[model samples]
Structure formats: C-alpha cells, structure tokens
Target: MPISQAAQRLPDDAVYVRPRMAHYAAVSRQIMAALENISPSVEQASVDEAYLDVSGLERLIGPPETIGRQAKHIIKNTVGLTASAGIGPNRFIAKLASEYRKPDGLMVVHPHEVQAFLDPMPISALRGIGPRTAPALRQMGLERIVDVRQTDPALLERRLGLRLAQVILNQAHGRGSDEVQLHSVRQSISKETTFEQDIVDQARLRETLLWAAQEVGRTARREGLQGRTITLKIRLENFKTFTRQRKLPAPTDDDTVLYRQAWALYRESGLAEHPVRLLGLGLSDWQQDAPSQGDLFDTPSHPSEHAQTPQRDRRTRLFQTLDGISNKFGQNAITLGLRRKT
Candidate 1:
C-alpha cells in the first residue's frame, strides 16, 4: 500500500505509522549475527540480505538444505522474524532461489540443474532488468532468459548497448561471480534535502547546496578521506532529476572547494528558471590523506607555488580551525561568511 493509504488504515489509537531507521539497524545487526554463526565468510548484500560461503561446512552442518533450514531457524530464534534462504553453487542462482520461495521458505539449486532452472524464467526476472530496459529486451524478441542465449551478441548490443547486453547474456548462461567478499570499503559520502515546497529562489538553492557540501566535507574528514569528484543533484518540481559532476585535479576534503565545484555544476545544469524540490551534493573517487613530501627541485616561479598562494593556504588553515571548533562545540557553533546576514 502507499504510505498515505497505510496511514489512513492505521487505528485511531496508533502512536506512529512510519519507517524507523534505528529499529531497522538493530534488526540488521541481529540478522548479521545469525549469518556469522553459519559462516565466517559472509557478504552483506543489503540491510535485509546477505551471502554466506558454506562450501566446506557440509561435513559439520549436513547438506545445503539442512544448513538453509538452520539459518532460517537461527534468524527466527534471534531476531523474531522469519527469513527465506537460497542454497546454490553461485550468488546469482542463490539470489533467485531465495526469491523462488520467499517469506519463510528455502529453495536449493544444484550445480547440474543451474541452466535448466534459469532457462524457463522470464528475462525480466534477471538482475538489472528494470521497467525501462525490459521493454527494450521484449522489442528485440527476447522475452525469456533462454532467448538472450539464442540472440546474436551484436544484435543485442545494437538494442541495449554493449555493457548491458554482455551482463544480461552472462546472467542468462547462469555464469555469475560467486565470490563472497567479507569486507566492504566506503566509496562515497553525500548529503541531500527535499524542501517542503518547491523553491524558485536561486539564493535559497545555493544556500542549500552550501549546507550539503559542508555536511559531506564534515563526514569525509571524520572518515579520514578526500575525494576527486564532486557531484550536484537537482530535482525539479515536475519530479525530473538531473545530476552534474566535476573531477578535481587533486582530492580535497575542504567544504569551500566542494561547494565551489558543486556551485559550478549547478550553474551548468541551467535549472535556475525551474523550481527545485530537492538539492544534493556528493563526493566520490576517494583517496586517503597522506603526508605531502616537498620536492627538492621546487622552483620559486613554479606553477605549483602559484597554486598554493599564502591567501589560499591561510583560508585552508582557517577552515581546519573552524572544523576543530565545530567538533569541540557543535555543528552550528561556526558559520561561513557567505552564510552571514548582510
């Protein structure tokens, strides 16, 4: 049901009817613990799903079916929530198997039956096949998963482009990577806000962009990371979203630099005439902050010297100081000059 419909259905005595992040996080921890007990090599697919490598544990835990049953039991016992389990030779098969018997059930696919199991399924059942791309596949007379294997690669490429065609073809063949990566590294940090009403004022939008940049910078610094690409996202009142990004010559955790790049991208978007419902800023292509080494061949007239002028260096130090003060007190303890009242 829609959120509005769900709210309407709520009883008069109900306290709240909404999603809760804290409760979700707590439940995720319980689920993770249950998976960890089954296998040390576990990859978290999402908040509600995970992949576990239990290849060598057959002797200790019986067959894959038994293990799946155990996992379901553990999750239910620990988290008080029923979970579906999928056992297969690879991640792709396992994912599909899980969905085959969802909401407290288990499905297992053997290695020999992989092709037979997948061939009968619709092309839309394959991963990465969404509403937009499904019609394109059907247009090419590729309706079933088996149709992709029969279709010419060049023809598929012409219809869906090369990368997507290759991916779909690979999945159709039941050839998927099964590596269960245990550790996940952080890739990007972002902040965004949706206004209560569409904002036509360019000044307010720019201010919101600045605020987003500040939040992203703060998070990046806290994580001891810097990024090369800065992205700006704008969502118009009509619900159309657009994004623009700029790649910096060097990674930076500076909020001012992030804001300037985001501002440039926002200007390039040409959305000033359009009322915006949402604004966002993001930083990616992360790099760790390493100590800089001075070059022995550095010259007084070098371009690098001009790039790091005394004024810019002072401003950088000032921002660093402001970050420190903000950390000591609170986020609202300091404000940039641009944010000050005239």
Candidate 2:
C-alpha cells in the first residue's frame, strides 16, 4: 500500500521518528570490530549481515558450530543485539542458511549436507530470483532448486537472460565464491524523512533540509571523507520522486555548504509548489583523506559569502566547536542557526 493509504489506516497515536543512521553505523562498527577479534577474515555484507571465514580456525575453535556460536555470543555481548549465523561450504549455502533460521538462530550446512539442505527449497529461495523471476520459473514447472538443476541450461537461458540464468544455476547447485573481503568502503551517506502529513510550506521544507545536511556533514567529518556532489531528493504527495544535484567547486564536509548547495538545487527544481511527503539529502563522490589545509586557509571565489577566505576559517572553527559540544553532550545539544535572526 502507498504510504498515504497506510497512514490513513494507522492509529492516531502512532509514533514516527527520523532514523538515527549515524548511531546505527556506530553500532555496526562495534559489531564488526568485535567479530574481527574472532577471525580477521570478516566481510561485512551489510550493516547487519557479515560473512566470516572460520575454516582456518576450525582447529583452534573446535569446529564451524563452535565458531558460529562464539561469534553470536560476542555480537550479543558487545552490541546487545541477537544475530543469526550460517555455516556452509561456500558463500551461497552460507547466506541461505543464515536466512533459514533468523533472529538469534544458527544453522550449519556441512560439505556433505549441502545438496540435501538446498534441493527441496523453493526456486524463489535462490538469490536474485525474486517475484518477477519466480513467476517465470514456476511457469516452466520449475518449483524447486532440484527442478532448476534438472532443467536444461539452454531452455533456462531462453527464458531468462544468459547471465542471470547462469548465476541462478550456479546458486541452485550450491556453488559460490568463498572468499571473504576483510575491508569495504561505503560509497555514500544519506538521510531521509517521511512525514505523517504532506507539507506545502517552503520554510518547513528548508528546515528539514538543514537538519539532514547537519547529520550528513557530521557523519562525513567523523569518517574523514568529503564529497564533490550534493544531492537533493523529493517525493511529492502523489508519490512522484525526483532528484537534483550539483557538483561543488571542490570537495566539502561542511554542513552549511551542503545545505546551501541542496537548497539551491531545490529552488532550481521548482518543486516548492507541490505538497511534499518526503525529503532526503545525500553526499557522494567520495574523496577519502582529502588534503584540506589549502581549502581551509585559501578559499576559492564563489557567489556565496561563505566561500570567502576570512569566513572560511570562521566557519571551520564554528563547526569544530559544534562537534566538541556534540561529542561532550549529544548531537542535539547545540544546534547551528540556519539563518540570522532579525
């Protein structure tokens, strides 16, 4: 159902919140750090999902089951969150096994038990085979992974594209890459909000944009990253979504600069006339550990006075003070003013 319809049906006292993505990322980092203590070969699949290569630790850890249990124990103790772990010969079976028993459960599929564990499962259980692809497979009388393995490769290829068919076939047979990536970098950071009621006031929209920019900038600075592009996302009451972005003269991790850029994009888009249901802001085109000494002291020419050299240092110091206060207290302890008071 559309959010509007869902909203209509919800209880009057239902509560909503702007998700605290930075806090969640902090918790995820703690979880990953704890897991790394068990095995150095840990690949974070997502914020909550990860793959750990414990094959090398079987001798010391007892076996796969012992390793899985230990990993779960560490996560629960470190983060106060329950985790599901799957152990298998390869990544494919392991991923499926993880989902098989979820929310503080563990399932291990040994090398000899792989086929028996996977064959009876529905074809939809195969990764990448979602609703759209499942219907096609069911139409072909392929209801199970065993059925897909029995089906001809040529016929499956004809129904689905060659690449997808090959990938699905490989997963159906319990074959997948076992290599775990120890390090990964996030491509982007974003924050968004959905309102319980549609809003037409431009001031309200800009206020929300300011909040998003502050959070995005704070997260970027903490991670030691800057972005060359700032993106503004809008979703109207009718559910039509649109985005506009502009590249900066250089990279920045400044909240004021991010808000100014996003606001400029929003005005150019001519979207203020419509009632907005959702608003989002994002920073991307990552520059990790970008040199900033020159940017801080020598500012380039720009239409906004915020780019002037004197104000540039002032802005930097101001944000540094803000971060200090936030760290000592909390994110909401001190709020940066979005506009000069009359």
Candidate 3:
C-alpha cells in the first residue's frame, strides 16, 4: 500500500518494518551452493523471500525435481529458514513458482507448460496485479491467467498501458522473468526513529533527523562506504509513510552531505501536512570510499588491516588514550564518527 493511503487508516500503534540486508546477505552467500550446479543469483526481497536464478544447472542434478529437493535440504540444514524452490526459464518464473508453493515446496514449470500452469492461477499471481487490479480484472471477467491471455493484448494495453500489457502477455505465455540489470552501488543507508506517540512539534523532528544522519554517516565510515543518494522517509500518525530521494554530484560519507541531502528529501516526502510518528534518513548509490582523516593532534590513526599484531597494539594504545581522557574529564568530552550525536 502507498504510505499516504495506509497512514489514513492505520492504527496509532504499529512497529515500523526494517529490512535487514546484512542478515540476508549472509544467508544468500551461505545458501548459494545448495541450489545444485547453478551459480545462484540471489536478490533478497524481504527477510523471508529470496529471488534466485537457477537456469541450466538441472542437468548436473539429474533433473529439476531432484535439484529442488537437494536445494531445500541444504537450505533447511544450513540457513534455518524454510524455503520453496521455483524453477522456470527465468527469475520471474522461479520466484512465482516458489510463492505458489511456499513453506518448503517446490514448483517446476518447463517452457511447454507455461500457459497450462498459469491460466488456472489467479490474476494476482502476475506481477503488478495488486488487489485493485485483481478486482478490476474480475469485474471484466478476466480473473484468471487464461482470461487475461484470451483478451486482446491491444485491448489490455488500452486498459493498463502498453508496457504493462505486454508484460502481462509475456508472463501468460510463460516468460515471466524480466531483464536482469545490475546495480552499480549501494542505493542508500537510513535510520528511522518511531515515536510511541505522534509528535506535532517541529523542533523535535529536526533533532531526530540530525541524530539519524550522524548515525548513518558513522555506519558508512565503518563500511568504508560513500553514497551519491540520500533519502528521507516519514511515517505519519495514520500509518501512512512517504519517502523521497536525491542524487548527489559526488559520493560522500560526510555528515554534512547526509544532513543537507536528507533535509531536502524530507521536505519532499509529504510529511509536512501530517503529524509524524516516525522519521528515517538514508544514503544510497554507495561506492567504496577511503576513511576520513581524524584530528591529527588528537590521535594518530593506524591502518585497520595492517599486520594483525601491529594493528592490535595500535588499537590498544588508542583505547588507552581514550580511557585516560574519560578518567580525567567526562564521556561527553569525547566523540567520534556517529558516536558524536545519535
């Protein structure tokens, strides 16, 4: 659902959803080898569903059915998440097949069985056909795949636009997976704070964004990452949320960049008119970047991956200096990276 529409009707108390890319990243790497002879291409859709491409590996495993069985066993044994396998010509087919039989199911659809397999399924099985579209199709006696395929492709185009209609036709004909495009860099990094109660004040919101940006920048530094994209998201009292993003001329991990870009994106996110319960800021289009230099007079930095023993001693000396400062003054007297504000 669109954030604006959802917010208008949502209850006041719902926890925000977060995507744990790190966890899923680890899982994908771990699960990659399990899917037979395939060099898996995993896209984490959520914490749960993963999109994988397993073309042509079937021959090595004897057949698709056997490959699916072996894949399921390995995933269950290793990752601890029950997964379903979908086999088709492309990623689209694989993902749809997986969803059709979830919680440890395998679906294998050869090119020959595309229409026979799809025509009986509900229209919702097709991508981009949401609840609204399903009802619309049903109203037009086009609730199933065959109903949709039987309708003139041009006629469907008139109703849903040419690109989308053709997309539907391709899927009905058993060619569901779209083109594969590689992302060049990380899109964004964001942090959000969801308040227990809706906040009507402007001052508090600014403070929260400031804190969030600092934290986001800190993480960026830790990963040696920089991004050209900055995004701001806001959740209103009604359960609606909105997000906006901006692209920068150069990638950076600087706190100033995060603050300015996020500020601009926030203004565009449609949060101004509604009382907000949550605010999020993120950076995207990330590229690997060098770490920033610190205050030279305060601390001499050591390389993170320098010879293991030397690096350890350097870190210990740095910690000792920090401890001495804390002992003499106070915790507030010292700050670094994201530790400064949020």
Candidate 4:
C-alpha cells in the first residue's frame, strides 16, 4: 500500500519523520502497553503488523481474548490509535490473525483451530510470499494454500530454496514454527528530513548540516561513544538520490570534524545543482574515543626547546600561530569566497 493509504488505516495520529513510511512506532508501543496481563511479553516484530505471542499468557489474563480486548481498548482510548490483534499458539499464527483484518482488527487462533484458520487464506497472505512469487505459483497451477500444501515437499523444496519451501508448506497447513528471538542487537541511529520545499540555497544547506552535526554529536557524547564514519544523503527534486561518506583521520566525537567532513562532501557532490527534497545524516561504526580532558592549548608543550627540521618546524609553528590568532579573534580571519551561487 502507498504510505499515505496505510497510514490512514492506523489507530493513532502518530508522528513520523517520514510520512510515506506509515511508521507508528510510538502508538504501537502504547497499544502494547494497554494489554494488561500479557504486557510483560517482549514485543517481537514491528513490520506492517506486529507478531506478538500471547500463548502462555492465558493463565494471568483470564483468557487470551481478555488481553486482546484490553489491548484494543488501550489503542482506542489512551493512544487514540487502532490496532488488530491476533492471539495464537505461536508467532506465525498471531501474525496471520493480525492480517485477517488489517488496520484495526483482531483474530484468535486456538491451538486446535490453527489449521482451519490458515487453510482459507491466500498464499499472498503468508509473510514472505511476494507479488512475483504469487504470480509464478498461479502460472504453475498451484493457486491456493492447499495446492502449496498438497504439492510434494521435495518438489516445493526443489522449486523454492529448501528454507522457503518448508516455510510455504508450513503456512499452507497453518503450521509455522519460527523461533522467536526476543532480543535483537542495535545497529545504527539515523535521522532523515523531507523538506517543505526543495532547495538550492547554499547558506541554508550549510546551516542544516551544522544543525545535524550538533545534534548527532550531542547524542554520541551522551551515549559515551564516538563515530568513525559520517554519512550524508540527499534526494533531489526529480526524486533521484545519492549518498556520500567520509571517514575521519581518527574516530572523533568532535562535532567540528563530522560537520566539516560532511559539508565538504556535500559541496564536492555538486548537490546544489539539483533542488533537493530530502536530507539525512548518520553516524556509525562507533567506538569510545579517549575522554578529552581539554583543548590542544590545555596540554603543556615547551616552546623553549626546539630540535627538529626547521622547514617542518616552521610549518607546524605557522599553523599553530594561525590557530591561536583565530581563537583570539574570529573565524573570518580566513575567508573562502563562494565560487558558485544558488
């Protein structure tokens, strides 16, 4: 579904950085919380639907439907959001239940009822079945779930890869046995912006990069980490997009380095030529840079003793002198004229 269409079906007025993604992560969390008894269960997945398991939770919640109704109520009341819940013997069944009526509905599949519940749903309803695969199945004359189930397991395995073959056959029979790994490792943090108006303004663009750098830096420092790679992403008015990245000389938590490198890359990319509709920045491959005690001037260095190449020494001294001058005065001590204008 188009993001806007899918979003309309959601239970809440959730805020999303990307309007088209139809992401309602916050509202989804609120709905999960309203489910009182099985609330302790770990939330498993957050795809188009959530695959939450409420199997053994019956004893605490009076019944599975009790928890389901409560979850629905919470989504409606507290979150002003709507959700459909599927209660089943396992993750797969629950996902199937949620799909029965998408955009605010519920389904219950008791262990004994799993088969009857699954048999009627189309193959496209199964999680991994894609549009292309569904068409291929139709051409092969295996149009329904039962057809997939009745096909020789070995034949299905031969046609699809072994793993997919087993999964498809299992779904056809309303018997999916995917192990739930409640814990997943964190990878990276990213932020993206869709501009109100596509832009070619260099000054505004530079300010945006600076703002992003400060935000990313504050987050990284607060987490007690530093990133080695800074990435810049841009989408143009025509919708063509590109990404560029720069790896710093050393992993630094310093905002100055990240923003400088990111800005340099943006300029070199010639993105200003195309009015840009979106921008994104990401910091990744993080590690702890040693805690900075103070600035370069804070560390004591003796100017009295000098024993090195005079030419190299002169350049180093010259650079430091210029830096001191800028620190005491202002950055306009050095001026870079704009070679191009928007």
User: Best-fitting candidate, measured by TM-score?
Assistant: 2
What TM-score does candidate 2 reach?
0.83
TM-score of each: 0.67, 0.83, 0.65, 0.68
What is residue 143's positional error in candidate 1, in angstroms?
3.4
On a 0 to 100 scale, what is the lDDT of residue 293 in model 4?
A: 19
The clash numbers for all candidates, in the given order, read 0, 0, 13, 4
Give lDDT tens digits, candidate 3, residues 43-146: 55544555555555666666888777877777888878777888777777777788788767899988787678888988888888876667767777897888
Determine which window of 10 residues in candidate 2 has minimal summed lDDT.
Answer: 291-300
User: How accurate locally, in lDDT, is each candidate?
Assistant: 0.81, 0.85, 0.67, 0.65
Candidate 1 — what's its lDDT? 0.81
> lDDT ranking from best to worst?
2, 1, 3, 4
Of 1 and 4, the candidate ranking higher by TM-score: 4
How are the candidates ranked when ordered by TM-score, highest leading? 2, 4, 1, 3
Which residue window of length 10 is worst by lDDT in model 1? 290-299
lDDT of 4 by residue, 225-301 (tens): 66678899897765567899887644655555556777778888977678877777778876665433121112235
Q: Of the candidates shown, which would achieve the greatest lDDT relative to the real structure? A: 2
List, residue by residue over 1-342, the lDDT tens digit for candidate 2. Answer: 755576567786766565666688799989999999898888988888899888879888888889899999999999899999999989988998998988788999998999899899998888899879999999999999999998999999999999999999998889999888776767888888888788998788888898998889888988888999889999987668899988876788888788877887888898878999899999999888764422333546776644336656677788789888998999889876767321
lDDT of 1 by residue, 160-241 (tens): 8889988999999998988999877567888887776779987887788878878788878777888888888887765677
Name the runs in model 4 displaced over 4 angstroms.
Answer: 1-37, 47-53, 175-182, 214-229, 245-258, 284-342
Question: Can you list the residue pairs that collide in candidate 1?
Answer: none
